[model samples]
Target: MALPESARLEGPILQELLALGGEERLRVLYRRLLAYFPHLDESERDCASARWRTLVQRAGARLVKKGELRREAGRWALTERGRQRAEAEKMLVEPPPEESPRRALSHEELQAMLVEIGRLLGKHAEREHERYDVVWKDSPLSPRLSHVFEVQVHGKLESALAKLKHAYDTQRSKPVLVVSDARDERRAREWLRPYFSGSFHEIG
Candidate 1:
């Protein structure tokens, strides 16, 4: 059974949970909701019950369709517009002022870091080679590729994954996708599972 129709979970409350979690797998978010609303009937809280799950799932889908949330990699996260709404409603939790924010890395810097990592591993690494954003070779003279990286700070996820898939098919190089945030990384991981299968080994 689900919560009473009169006591149904509110959309804003779900958004608040997503904002608080930064990004959360659907199951985890559901569990958090149970904790938040402990007065609900036991039947509604039972994992075996589809009613509660259905309600939550529909609510999440509605938010996604409304452009206020994103469902990626089996996880849900607030979009920029969603965050703004949450903040305006004073539902978002403020971070502690004592902690300083980490500097966001730019696309070029991310590529540079990957190149350095490749070099440290004793492989020759270079940025912006043909269609690939970064690639590693055994040596500058070697024609074979070892690892291929696509740095995606902002752009189509399909485009980046497509290039990696091509590299794997032709060069048999290990494919890696680099993203600025954890959210994108998870999103990439979800997309990789069905399409790339195990061809792509890692996401950083």
Candidate 2:
């Protein structure tokens, strides 16, 4: 008996989806499959593209045949068997492990690692300063800080303003000033006023 369209494509599609951990939406799966094997004919990509709805139906049919996927509340999730297959395939391709270290880091060694990390970060920030309009440290209630860079172009200021507002809403701490510059300092100040609460300044 001749197989249906979805069933015909099932083996290759299932292999690809399993390789990708089998948790992707149909569209994402489709794109990744094409990216990995670009020679797959257009007809193959179109096999399930009658409509967006049809894509899921085709994927469902394919998964049903393998007995390794299930639909739960409009989302496809991998079964345990599916996860095992993915893991097996991954193990086959993974490189051999390197030799383990003789001993764990001592306190002095850990402190040296921290100092190296800070030096690398300072160099990275210096490079970013050369290429961007503004760079600032984003700190919250925690001691850790995240760096944010802003380039003024094509509504970028507006984008930065929105991001700053989001950060303020989510985090309870204030950001540090490492370096900053502005094309229109007044405009930058105006945009950041609501979010910064009068803590904006130049970094030396």
Candidate 3:
């Protein structure tokens, strides 16, 4: 039930409703995806997203039937029961599985690749807690390996990039960045090109 990031969405409607604080216009909820993936071609992505409302309605109906939410004035809001349920579920669901680091890796084999890179470059990789996810200092990978590895690791990539830029500047490291697939990498490279003309690599 989770929507793919390439589809300009993140979901399981119940989870989204919870994030919206239990109330949101169906259309507004879908638009959250657009805000994150704004660069997605309208013809391709928007056309696909056009059906989200129907999906939301279908999912929300179940919640409404369970007394978890209420529909009024064409908007949906969480009922007290829903709020309580969401809190109860949060203990089991905080740090969602979809946001895990291995998401970009199509297969388990890639984890070994990341580890090999860290070993070859003499950098340490820690998937959790600390200023950045991975750190490389004074290694040959110095500027290249020194980065906040990309993922939809945060709720919003914009927030993540902001944190990355701040860390990059404050940490007195190299400058030059961004990437995912080739298309996304190109767009990000273009964005960073004016300020940095160094080697840039794309990692899923």
Candidate 4:
């Protein structure tokens, strides 16, 4: 995606926050960057566009300290003052920059895509950070064949799961488990370990 010479991802961050219309945790925001988040740092440092999207996210995050935003519970929101300025400058309502195919999906959209792959007619799999890079096939030959995940790294499970359920309302597989971090991953693993000794597929 083409980031502005100055605001880079920070500009879009501001608009996304406005579109959100309420307080949002940084981790939640980070997850919204998903699949694109982890690679931000290792990208070209000289080029803001080159940096991993997560690095851009961090730059966007710095807006908080800059007094352009507000925070609570480690979450962030558009400050009334910032919102007012954005309204006048028209920064909060700009369209997103063009992006590569993968970059197009928001964090939630990415997760939805992952879960959709689970239901593919034949064997299929996809993976990323919060998970791993691996290849697997959907098969009854495998003992573990249940469970679905939308690899968003943030947001409360209640709303996340609700949105996910709304997307695909079939109980054909295990419920879509929404996790915030590794702790949740461990908890889920421990909880599911006893029942399914088979593979634990991840899509993050």
* Per-prediction backbone clash count: 0, 1, 0, 5
How do the residues 102-184 of candidate 1 rate in per-residue lDDT, one tens digit apiece? 88899999999999999999999999998899999999999988999998789887788879888888988888877677556
lDDT of 2 at 88: 64
Q: Rank the candidates by lDDT, best first.
A: 1, 3, 4, 2
- What are the per-residue Cα lDDT tens digits for candidate 2 across 1-204? 222355434344556567666766665555544433334456654534554336446756777667777766555567787666556665443323445756644434443443455455652222233233233332224332344333333454445454444444454223222113334657656656664553332211
Q: How many backbone clashes does candidate 2 have?
A: 1
Worst lDDT 10-window in candidate 1: 90-99
TM-score of each: 0.46, 0.30, 0.35, 0.32
List pairs with backbone clashes in candidate 4. 25-75, 39-52, 40-52, 40-53, 123-138
Each prediction's Cα lDDT score? Answer: 0.72, 0.46, 0.52, 0.51
lDDT of 3 by residue, 126-153 (tens): 3322544444444544444354543432
lDDT of 3: 0.52
Candidate 2 global CA lDDT score: 0.46
Residue lDDT tens for model 4, 1-52: 3323335556555666776884576665654543322333443333324344
Q: By TM-score, rank the candidates, best first.
A: 1, 3, 4, 2
State how far residue 38 of model 3 sits from its true place (Å).
13
Give the worst 10-residue stretch by lDDT in candidate 3. Answer: 195-204
Off by over 4 Å in 1: 1-97, 183-188, 191-204
Q: Top model by TM-score, which number?
A: 1
